[model samples]
Target: MYSKKVKLRFVFVIVFLILIVLTTFTVLKVLKDNVVYFKSPSEINLLSEISNKKIRVGGMVKKDSVMMNNNKINFIITDFKNELYVTFSGTVPNLFEEEKGVVAEGFLNDKKFLVADKILAKHDENYMPPEVKKSLGE
Candidate 1:
């Protein structure tokens, strides 16, 4: 025959575990909807399905790729191995320029181009986001 104390302890442990599991599940589900992953041009190319979800793409602005048309700017981002075109109508950071590290936050248009809502440029020659550096391998 099992003692009452042991049965009570087992029930308590089960309830505690269930509570922990439920909390973890809820947190993960909430984060899943909010999470936006950063990708490079090459990674974007491999994606089979493109969505309008907000995301970030980081890499170097290809040399001589920057162009201006009235208030709009267009550029190409490259990971050396692959490249992606990006267009933005907003004011760009002063540090933004060709052949510099930049991260564009926006939605991809059929994986061929990114319509950026924000453009983040590197602070200096030596600074780059770790995610972007890893993607560029430099």
Candidate 2:
């Protein structure tokens, strides 16, 4: 028969383990909810169903596919194997241009189209911002 002190210690250890497990699970769940996955045009095309959740689609902006109408801008992102049409109604970054790598954060209306709330231009490692270049006198 274990003493009262031993039983109390066992209960304390069990409670501590349960608390740790619950905290870990809670943190994981919050992280999962906040994570925004990035996908290419080809990967998006392979999706069986489109969800209302937000996602990021990254690829090269197809040449001659950028068009502006009023406050909206439309462009096509292609991964060589597939293309996704994107519509955005905000000022794009200076680096955003045709034939450049870009990532659009938004919701997908279908496999072929995305309604972007934000646009992020991606550049190669060799690229530098104009301000930095000027400051560095390069």
Candidate 1: Cα lDDT at 132: 92
TM-scores, each model vs. reference: 0.64, 0.66
Which pairs, if any, clash in model 2? none
Model 1 segments beyond 4 Å from truth? 1-37, 124-138
Q: Kindly list the per-residue Cα lDDT of model 1 for residues 1-138, writing each as its tens digit.
A: 899999999999999999999999899888973554467899899998998788899899999999999989999999999899999998998889887889999998877799999999865547678899899985
Over 5-69, each residue of candidate 2 has an lDDT whose tens digit, in order, gives 99999999999999999999898888973554578999899888999989899999999999999
User: Where is the poorest 10-residue window by lDDT in model 1?
Assistant: 31-40
Q: In terms of TM-score, which candidate is strongest?
A: 2
- C-alpha root-mean-square deviation, candidate 1: 7.0
Backbone clashes, candidate 2: 0
Off by over 4 Å in 2: 1-37, 128-138
